[model samples]
Target: MASGKKRGKKPEVEFRNTQLADALQTQDMAAVAFALRHGPTVVPLMRPGARDDPRDTGEVWTFRDPKTGQVALLLFSDALHKPEAMPKAVGLHSPEWLRAFLEVHGDEITTVFFDIAGPHPMQASPADLIAALDA
Candidate 1:
């Protein structure tokens, strides 16, 4: 069975949430909110590497509208689902981390995009998402 294919070791922590992935596919706001509040999510990072563990936090990548001066936060159910157009680096973030991030950046971030430019794309207001997380 020793063919020349080198396999990497399995990650200590898995960063994918099936519920969130399904909710994104369905484009259900309520389900998405629930999943976001209860499950881990993948966030693009400005750094140069990908971290499979949720314990590691990095500088989150955000999109800013030049015309409106509004910022958008892009998230994914899994790091694999991140779009190629986005930053190559990614971080697996816990629900608590996500809530705190939104609470701190809520005023500046106007929009939150789930799997943007992908098979399942959904958008929500930062205020609504923050409320959902609180509830």
Candidate 2:
């Protein structure tokens, strides 16, 4: 008998640094919209060296994925050269920031497109969050 769930599926990709740069360089309008239609996702994560405690985490640093429960990355930059250029951690209301951010990552995000902010866009379960974030 076959298993209830499908098997022989290719394993998911998570934290594949090499592939990241590619996603950022190939974004388009339709792709971005597809992400919005699905739902807002991802949360900015703080730079480990920058934050002391979790509360101190910056707003513009990471994105938490709802389906995968993984906190992808969102680096906010101010000067691009200056060390402090990292964007200040932004909460949900920063529409301008969100737009700019998506532009910056226009090449690296192959699977998920569009940048997200605020709290987890939905009340994501741990497993679901992991799946999406990890994907």
Which candidate number maximizes lDDT? 1
User: Which candidate has the top score in TM-score?
Assistant: 1
TM-score of each: 0.81, 0.25
lDDT of 1 by residue, 1-135 (tens): 699988988877665778899998888889998998888888899973434854557789999999998899999888878878887987777788988999999888989998887678899988888888888
TM-score of 2: 0.25
User: Which regions in candidate 2 have their CA more than 4 angstroms from the true location?
Assistant: 1-42, 47-90, 113-135
lDDT of 2 at 26: 50
Clash pairs, model 1 backbone = none
Report how far off residue 68 is in candidate 2 (Å).
15
For model 2, residues 1-135, the per-residue Cα lDDT tens digits are 767986688874232121222232354333333333233333333433243564442445544467875554442111121123334333331323334454565344333322222111112223332233334
lDDT of each: 0.85, 0.34
lDDT of 1: 0.85
State the lDDT at 104 in candidate 2. 62
Clashes of each: 0, 35
